[model samples]
Target: MITVIGTGTGAPLPPDAEAALAGAGLVVGARRHLAAAALPDTAARIVLGPLAPALDAIERFLEKLEPEKPDERRPVVVLASGDPGFFGIVRALAERFGSDRLTVHPGVSSVATAFARLGLTWDDAVVVSAHGRDLRTAVNVCRAHPKVAVLTGPGSGPAELGAALRSSERVLVVASALGSGEEGSDEEGAEGEGAGGERVERVTPAEAAARDWGPAVSVVLCLDEARVLSPVRTVAGPPPGPAQWALAEGDFTHRDSMITKFEVRALALARLGPRLGEHVWDVGAGSGSVAVECARLGAAVTAVEKTLDGVERVRANAAAHGVDVSVVHGAAPTVLSDLPDPDAVFIGGGGRELPAIVTACARRARRSVVVAMAALDRVPAVRGALVAAGLDCDGVLLQSSRLAPLPGDVTRLAATNPVFLLWGVRPPARSEGVAQ
Candidate 1:
């Protein structure tokens, strides 16, 4: 049987953890984790370095166990920081080896410690991990949401996040060495020993990093007031039906020839599925109609438009609707590189490089892609590119007409231009459990 244990960040093992470790024949964890736990001198230790190597060590340990020896009992123990199940190794192990084969023992998570220090509740706060190459999602969440708690690693630690956030007005709280009494002691005493031996109060980002944090865990909290600006418009309950989407094109102020038609825009919005704490790219955002609608739905939107007049029109529409949109003046593929990875992308122009832009967005988009085309020839090319990027592709040809009053005092259908609406939903990663 496999036992997964969480050595609380900065803290020693609780009594129960010590009991579990006494029975362990083989222990798997980082060298630091093994050292912190006072285990029997004879217990076999397997050091975990990087992620791949750590996983390899666990596999090798299991393989070498003598299952056939009737008199021998082999108990494997895995050590991780914070709660093993939360952004730790337990989920990976359970996904790989199955939950039935293991038992989990959790310790106090760093998130809890950070919140405890600030005397705040975190049920509403979005928690993100910046471990390894996963910092982009955390960065985008910080950009779009008012409150976020980031678990920082070595390279992408608080300094890196602070540099990214210097422009924005956010309250940053960096708490290090949670759960460790020694690290906390140094912080408490850093202000100088007092007559009554009073503990030091909370410190800022610079002060926290200047001290030596032994066996540390750091959490960065950013707070902004702009996130709650728009009170939820729909009634305080779940949406009624799958077809009930808010903010139709009639809701926005758009120039006669500039706006994407209602039906096509609806399909594009559906594909984008904009949400709070995610970013969306509206390339060739002609009238800023798509960008405004996305921002209204709580996404941080960046509208890319090339023409000087088009950019002005987009800005006017955005202000008329009372939504914040970052208007970028540039061409596609070239302009898209510097922007944050989008949760979804909508291409309303970029006729020739539509395929290339779609490909680039596909690599970055976490959910879906939607492209609008007036020409039939571009439809197949766009669909092929999405398919090539492993997205499930689908399209619809929309033909609509508005009511026109004729000279004979009768209403007639005034046919509008035909539009091709294509969408692609990126297949879920193996870790996400199911496709969206």
Candidate 2:
């Protein structure tokens, strides 16, 4: 039978785990884990360095055991650090071999150990692992949320996380080698270690934000304002109604030519349903009105503008609205490459490359894409691209007029330039499909 045992990190194996290893016939685990477990000398042992080969070894072990007599009992132990179930090897094994085929023994996860060291609780903190090639989602989570516990890997470890959070004002707490005696000790042992304890540094956000840390590092980020705690907050503005967004042009500072009219912006915001934990890209983010409004609605927004003056204006507008927006200064498709993928995207310029950028965004988007077009000639091209990328397309023409003082003590309708908004929604999976 396959048995999973968690080797409490950087510490001796617990009594029960050590007993199980003593009776084991086949021991499978990383070299470090195997060494730490201190298993009795066994004939069968598998060393796991890389992952796929380790899985292959486990599969082979199972295959060889299938022919053995049913009455014959053989103990196969798998050693893992922290809790095996948490972003660990247990999930892979369970998926490949049925969960019923194995028994899992619990041990202290690194997250638990780290928090215990700090005398903290983690029920409220978001736990994420930057293991393997999954750093993007972790980075995004840190960007969108306040309290986070990150499990680090070799390349995507604490340093990478610190670098990502450096631009923002936040607090960072890092703990490494918890339960190990090597790194001096906790406050209790500090007096004994004396001068040696001085090397064990507990860095603040400002210091950690400046340096690149090493592996075996765990980090906690506390943002300036814990906005992620609540999904949405009421901003001081007109109440939610049919007039959803796109305030009158006078509401924002713009170079007249650079601003997207309020009527069209209303539709664009509607299409781009910005919410907490989602990312939105406002390409050609002229005046930054859309990006600012999206940010107000609580979505993490990145605004890309090309011109030096336009970039400055977008920042000013965002500040005027008392919202934070990451202003990216560069041209689209090119600039977008460096930014994180979005849940929704708004293309305000670059009609020729709108199709490509929209497609790229569609491939990455978890929900929707919205593009604003002033030139009617580009609608069909953008629509075709959306359709090709498996998105349902729709468009609307918006025109609005303001009441103005006339020559004869009366009001006149001052017509504004019309705008066309094109958008697409990626179809949900088949299981989520609804009846017609």
Candidate 3:
């Protein structure tokens, strides 16, 4: 049997884990874990680096156990940091050796510890790991949700996370050296200070990006201070997705029936596939209706509108919906240059420059580009642009009529203008750069 112990988050090992370690004949773990533990002098040890080799070493040790005397078999123990079962080595161990052969003792997780240090509850916060994955997903999550805990790794550390969120109005709480008893000052002092070797320092995203935080970082808390303390939730993880989407035109403050109709909005939302941990661009966001709807669905959205009234309208609509959308007040094709690349693009109101805007958006869109238009002439050019950008393009013409109340208290069909909806999806081979 193999024993797994989770420790190193400033907590003493439970008696069971300590007892397991004492009887271990072969111990395997990171160098820090090995150095911290009180292993028997006779115990053989392996310092973990690459995972496969460590598992191989453990397997070899287990194979050598004498089958004749099951009672005499010395235990093989693996040590990990802070709840190995949570995004840690437990899965790998369980996969290699059957789960039946392993006994796991979990410690307090860093996310739990970090929140404890701040004296805040974390059940409402979204926790994401950037280790061995793309930083953008974490960044996008940080953008969409008010509270998040990010597990740090080599390339996806505080500086990288901060760089991505520098423009956003988020506060980064860097928790370093957990359980080490290191001393740190509370510069912001908004939240209570870190108590132990865990030095929790709060800084703006820009400040975080500017500093070179070394490998000691355990986790980073990205918080929108305004909404940090949420209403007590019955369920966990990033507040469940909105109950409804494709809100009607009356729900938003739009000028003179300029909003995308509910039918088109519903189809556009389906093609866009906005979700948590994604970035979406809404070009020519006329009423910001699409932008607001996208934000409501949990994607980090940027709504670009050229006219001053349109910009104000978009912001107002977003505010009314209580969803956050970064409003860029400028025409598309040019303004899109300064924004980060998007997983999806929605074009709603590009007039004469429709084709150029579509080309610009298609080239940078990582997943799909969706264009909704009323003009038939612009379809060919937009299709050509999507094809040139190497996207597998498809389209549909939507014509719908809704029931209207007549003077006689009867219902009649009210025909809405037909709209052409085109969407271009990036081939799978070309869209593996980001993770959601």
Per-model TM-score versus the true fold: 0.64, 0.63, 0.94
Error (Å) of candidate 3 at residue 130 is: 0.6
List per-prediction Cα lDDT, in the order shown.
0.71, 0.68, 0.86
Model 1 Cα displacement at 168 (Å)? 4.5
lDDT score at residue 200, model 2, on the 0-100 scale: 26
Scanning candidate 1 in windows of ten residues, the lowest lDDT window is 185-194
For 279-389, candidate 1 gives per-residue lDDT tens digits of: 899999988888887877767788999988888888887778656677889988998898867889988988788889888887787889898999998888899989998
Give the top-scoring candidate (TM-score): 3
Higher-lDDT candidate of 1 and 3? 3
Distance from true location, Cα of 1 in model 1, Å: 2.4
Q: Which stretches of candidate 3 lie over 4 Å from their true place?
A: 182-196, 430-436
**What does candidate 3 score on TM?**
0.94
| 1 or 3, greater by TM-score | 3
Model 2: how far residue 2 lies from native, Å: 1.4
The predicted structure with the larger TM-score, 2 or 3, is: 3
For every candidate in turn, the CA RMSD to the true structure comes to 8.3, 9.0, 4.7
